[model samples]
Target: MTYCVGMVLEKGLVLMSDTRTNSGVDNISVFRKMFTWQVPGERIITLMTAGNLATTQAVISQLEERTKEPDERDNILLKSPTMFQVATEIGRLMRGIISERQDANGVKGRGRFTASIIVAGQIKGMEPRLFMVYPEGNFIEASLDTPFFQIGETKYGRPIILRGYDRQMSLEDAAKLLMVSFDSTLKANLSVGLPLDLQVIERDTYEAGHQHRIGHDDSYFAAISDGWGDALKNAFHSLPDYSFYRPDD
Candidate 1:
């Protein structure tokens, strides 16, 4: 399992995904779950995936292969005229791969090889958009009512985002909020570990804005992790004391 989030802010978009996958206690390992495709000044796309490792990897590989051999087939990521079309194309590809493999592997493998992905990016002249593609190939776009999407090991980190998210906040604040969500997840779950991969894309700029990997020794992440814990403890202590007995007693 893993934890990944893609948030759409008024200023831009922020995406983060941890790099861990586990089969069992002794078989735990790390694998990057974020992938990006960009065309410098024309377009920028980020895809974060979670679920069966093999299926996700296969979809990513096929997408990458499209970029390299554009003449042979429709390089939808490069040629899609709108962000919606891009999401549609990605959804189609995801479904195709999942279904194809399921047929070959048989009915018993139905849910075993399933995968889901979060697609975030913008085409030139388009607003930055975010979508969460389901394992079945259908998807839903992010909106003001729900401006972010998370997949895999989500319960631990979701509450933080719900209480803190603001569509008007700057990209920096959005990233910081996600870091806290990630820290909360890391503390509670072993299936999701880091170094985490993060990327930001500013509105109207058809280029990758900021990118980084947060490893164990990353100082800023270390501070965020420690600071959050201290803050929580202080908040708990600051709460008014409650008593079961009457104050006079």
Candidate 2:
């Protein structure tokens, strides 16, 4: 399992994903779940993937291959005129790969493979956009009402976002909020272990303003984890307790 989140903010986009995959308790491994492509000053794109690892890898590989081939069909890097189209192409690719794999293996319902992707970037002459692509090749754009999207092992980390998210928050605050969310998931879930990959894209720049791989020993993340826990405990204790409780009420 994995955890991935893509947030659309007034500043730009913030993406975070864990790097763990597990077949069983004894068989666990790490594989990067985030992929990025950039044309420097022209365009920058990032994708966070979750669900069937094989399907996601194949989709990414096919897209990469197309980008390398001059005569190949329009791939994620070339075919899409806007961030919207890029998301559509990625969704289509994901569905196509899953269908082909199922047919070849004859696994039917038992081996159904699926994946979800968060696509965010900007093309020259257009504004930055973020999209969440479903397994069926359909997607929705992030708007003011829904400014973020998450996939894979998401339930553990969603509440922080729901409670703290604000469209006008500074990128620094947004990144910190996401780290706290990740901290919550890491503490509660064994499947979502890290070295987390994070990228922050600033508006109109068409480049990643900050990108880093946070490992188990990362000091800043450690501080955030400890600080948040202490703060939460303090707040819980400070909340007014039930004063009129009755044993048989």
Candidate 3:
């Protein structure tokens, strides 16, 4: 399991994903789940995946292979005229791969090889867009009512995002918010581990504005983790005390 989040803000998009993939307690390993493709000044696309490692890796490998062969018309990441089309192409690819694997394995492969993806980026003339593609090949774009998406080990980090997200927030602030959320998830779940991948795309830049990997020794992340825990404790203590005794009743 892993945790990946993509947020849409006025300044641009912020994405982060954990690197842990575990089959069992002793079989744990790290694999990056975030992949990005950019056409310099033309467009930029980022995909963060979660679910079956094999399935996600297969999809990413195919995309990269296609990109390398310019003659391949299926290199939709670079050929798509619009961001929506790019997402549609990805959805189709994801669905095809999942279905093919499932059909080949019959009963044993049902949900075992399923995966989901969060695709975010900007196309030359369009506004930055974000989409969460489901395992079935369908997807929904982020809007005012839903400006972000989370997949895998989501329960632990979701509340923090819900309480703090703002559409107009700066990319820097967005990254900080994600760190706190990831930290909370890290503390509560063993499946999602360290060495997180982060990327920021400023609106209209058509390229990644910032990118970094947060390992266990990263001081900023360490501080965020520690500070958030203390802040939560202080906030809890500041709340008014509740009593079981009801004298008025």
Candidate 4:
């Protein structure tokens, strides 16, 4: 499992994903779940995936193949004229893979091969957009009413984002908000461990804005982990003490 989030802000977009994957308590490995594509000054597209590793890798590989194949100018991501079209194409492709897996297996209940994706980026003339694509190939875009999306083991972290996210906030502030959410998720879930990927795409630039990989030893993240814990404890203690009869009294 993983935790991936993408936020749409007045300034642009912010996305982050954790790198841990596990089959059981003892079987664990690290694999990047964030991938990005940029066509210089034309577009910058980023994808963060969560769920079955094989399905996500296959979807990514097919998209990459379309880019590298000479005869295929049909790379939907590189060639799409609008960000909406890009999201649609990705949904189609993702749905196609899951359907193919289900059909091939002949026995399908919940369908073991499942994955969800968060897509974010912009084309030169278009505003930045963010989307969450579910295993069924359907998606919902971030809107003014809901300015962000999350996938994979998302419950533990969602409350913080819901409380703190603001469309008018700066991209830097957005990153900070997500870090808090991610840190909260990380602390509660052993399945979602560290080493995170973060990317920012400023509107209209059609270029990568800020990109970095964070590991457990990172000083800033360490500070956040410690600080959040302390803050929560302080907040809890500061609340009114329950008025109960005491044995001493």
lDDT value for candidate 1? 0.89
**Steric clash pairs (candidate 4):** none
For each candidate, the alpha-carbon lDDT, in order, equals 0.89, 0.87, 0.90, 0.88
- In the predicted model 2, the residue pairs found to clash are none
Name model 1 segments beyond 4 Å from true: 66-74, 108-110, 246-249
Candidate 3 residue spans exceeding 4 A from truth: 66-74, 108-110, 246-249
- Model 3 earns a TM-score of 0.94
Q: Write the per-residue lDDT of candidate 2 for residues 1-249, one digit (tens) a residue.
A: 888888888888888999999988788999999888888888899999988989999888878775566676545565567887788788889888888888888867535687888898888889889898887778999998999998988898999999999988988888899999999999999999989999999888877779999998999999999899899999889997776876778
TM-scores, one per candidate: 0.92, 0.92, 0.94, 0.91
- Tell me how far candidate 2 lies from the true structure as C-alpha RMSD in angstroms: 2.5
When 2 and 4 are scored with TM-score, the better candidate is 2
Winner by lDDT: 3
Local accuracy of candidate 4 as per-residue lDDT tens digits, 93-163: 88888888888988476678888889999988778889888888788898999888889888999998988
- Let me know the TM-score candidate 2 reaches against the reference structure: 0.92
lDDT, candidate 1, 26-81, per-residue tens: 79888989888789888998889999898898888776564466667655577778
Ranked by lDDT, the better of candidates 3 and 4 is 3
Which residue runs does candidate 4 get wrong by more than 4 Å?
A: 66-74, 238-249
